[model samples]
Target: MKIASKLYRTGAFLAILLSSAGFTSCEKSLEEEAKTFINPDDFFTNETQCIQAVNGVYQTLYSIYSSPDYWRMVDLGTDVAYSIDVNSAVQNYEFGSGSNGTGSLWLNAYSGIKNANLVISRVAVAEIDNTIKQRILSEAKFLRALYYFNLSNTFGGVPLWTQEIDINAVSSLSRSSLADVRAQIIQDLTEAEMGLPLSYPSSDIGRVTKGAAQALLAKVYLFGKDWKNAKATALKVVNSGSYSLMTNYDQLFDVNTGFKNNKESIFEVQYLREPTSNTNTRTHSQISYYIPQRDAGKRTYAGVDFGNLVVDGWSVFLPTAKLVSMFEPGDKRKDIVLGFGFRDQKFTRFPKPGYPWFGSKFWDLNANGQSSGKNLYLLRYADVLLMLSEAENELGNTAESIRWMNMIRVRAGLPELAASTTRAEITNKIFNERAIEFVGEFQRRFDLNRWGKLIEAAKSVAVDNPVGAAKVKPFHQYYPIAQEEIIKNPNLEQNEGY
Candidate 1:
């Protein structure tokens, strides 16, 4: 109920960053004074305030990346990831309309959308520098489209809140069709591509760029099964000379505090470890859930040390054996997932050996507290290449498809597809490539669903847990509309089976 309060704001900045709250975006310790209330009239008249307003939109992203529940909703139950507790509702597909599988992502997306709506509407009337105003407006639109993209992917047709709206009247709204939502996303991304810069100065590395909008647009096209557009759009990015595949795979995913915005990054969610003792508040809590918790037993792992210490981590999820087996011999990316070492809370080595699928990409020996300031990748060059491969295959450009896919294979120390590889054969490798390439990135579910391979993926999961596979139903393609949202807005309809 309290989160709904943001939808009512006419548009205002709470001065979200640079607060005692530890909201760090760019390397710069931003200069917004954390204000306490809403009312757009009082804010957005100046560039600084407008900047603060956009930062507020970015703050909601923390809600997605910082929570274990969010991770569970996105990661577990996918074919590549396994639930340590297989009985979990999401892992076994036992959830219903009483709950949408996304955890608090629903509220978070709308919250960001509400803030973006505020910025889009209020900033235009203010007299800021014209170029800055357009860029800011485009940024807000891009973010709004991103939230909608996530919402559409998870829930199918959702209530589209393109701009701010009356909190009391939200109940009057109904779900918009997927086409409408997709169209709006495209329009916003197109404008963002036009208005955003090719790149930013060092201080602004994590902010979205024109290439990001293009890449996202390409993804949106791919998701809609628009092969022609997907191929063309992704090719534009490839030929645009704006990005490249990182030479070293490990460092590319070494998402520690200072490792963001590398050449391969298209869109990255910025995060920072805060000084306060509370680990749950502002920073990403990835390593806590991803790595093994403090253990009393000694581990036989050889790993990078944190201040000469192998700190302990919590174990909530593990990489499915199927995922580990997917990586071919000598594939460099697998090392990034396997064999991690850690100590017990007493700073002593425990008895257990290292575990599989350790959060190597996110681990930081220099964490400020229980959490680390690890940034998350929303889009990267490798993903674009894979999408290109898939799109090219769909459009019957077989040679081009393998060519695109091979770029990734060669980089990973795996051999390229043979020239004689058939389209059907390449299709399977493309799927396998995504599984290996995006391990731990929360991508498998989306890739499977879009490819109409979810049931097949569940079958693959059945190798370990037949019960989880048996629980899958046709309606499982989209999560049910949460019952609470239906209660709050009686006009909102439930997604078909729930």
Candidate 2:
């Protein structure tokens, strides 16, 4: 069995080149593209080679942000309001056909997982120095864990492929229980924490670090409702003092300052737009895609019509009235966070002449063009603080929960909650704070789910017009397993309630 497994793994590793061809082509054009190649024996022969392979894995991370599959699946579940212009057939929200939004997410996520698995398996057999080998393996494992985390959350139990699997073995795969998937995620993250460095040099700034692993682990624990573990891990991240809330939250997303490595950011999928440099090129920015043409007048790359814009219809993801109303009257975060209306150093609705109703703080109008270099913050210190608060509250540590919540509130220029606050009050406070703090950041859905309020929130957000009533049910909370995956692997079962 072991020998057969090894042979199958080797064959699976070879298949990565073919699978990667479709995904990797969009990023860069390889000079030496080969047909039907199985070169793993030579792929990890040196430190430089190993580093390049690892970088390829990082490139795959970009797909999570740029791919329509990822954005649609994540955005649909969130409170961020969308128009029908985004109606690519891929995003139709169908369950059984395996060609819906959920199906796209499933395929894209596994594509990434397969890439990571190739890196991990190949690096394991390479006779490199132990330290270098360990770190490379750790990076791959961290990425694999991240992919599985998304899968487990969205699809519930999913086929868990650890090592590279042969094309022939693909049909034999079965959906692992959520518990099993979570165990693997924890195991991978624990290994990543031990192997990853506490920090990286300036050149290696975008790479995962010990803090990223710890932060992710904290989030995973929180998602699982393992409060004690979540609290312990989050507190470790906080007390380590490795990160802090950025004094100016605006700077956290600023692209012009080259602020990709800001102190507040724990992990950001780094993107650059200079076409000349492959190292700093990124084509996905929601700001550029969603802003209106009038607001983006004469800005060529600024407005994407997406064929959905009507005379009155907004072009892209617009802030919800509920979301806009959630902000405090004088809160500084209200303007920087939501950009609703013009106020006397306060919040207002969209009445400005040229500015679109849904203006973005992340982008600025430059004479040169509509430049969008904003770092999409995947994890931030403020999230850690909130997770800490949630875990503490769940664990019945009210004082500690209050402390962390207050820390975040004070940073956002809001008053701290009173000591007499009840647990429900604290929970509501955190939810509202998160909504405002992370508007249009693709986090609201996950937050609602973890709090057992996803169905209610989804139903509430559905509307006949862009702003009123649509139907949402509890079954919609978790995306159905893609039908294609089920047909390919008999062991795979559709998620319950799908």
RMSD of each: 7.0, 7.4
| TM-score of each model, in listed order | 0.86, 0.83
Clashing pairs in 1: 292-313, 292-314, 293-313, 293-314, 297-350, 297-351, 297-352, 298-350, 298-351
Tell me model 1's lDDT, rounded to 2 decimals.
0.72
Per-candidate local distance difference test: 0.72, 0.66
Distance from true position, residue 461, model 2, in Å? 3.0
Q: After superposition, how far is residue 302 of candidate 1 from its true place, in Å?
A: 11
Tell me the tens digit of each residue's lDDT in model 2 across 1-498.
Answer: 122222223433434554543433334445446654535655678886676676666665556776545655665545554444544432233444455465356766787787778788888888889898889889888988888888888877788888776645655887788899999999999998888887776667778888899999999999889999998998878887889988876666555565677888888776555433322235455554444443335322223322322222233555555666677766767656554332332222232333334544544332113334355777889999999888888877788889999887887778888888888888888888888777656577777777888656655555412221343456666777667767767787776665
Q: Highest lDDT, which number?
A: 1
Q: Candidate 1 has what TM-score?
A: 0.86
Badly placed stretches (over 4 Å) of model 1 are 1-12, 15-38, 255-258, 274-282, 297-312, 340-355
lDDT, candidate 2, at 111: 73
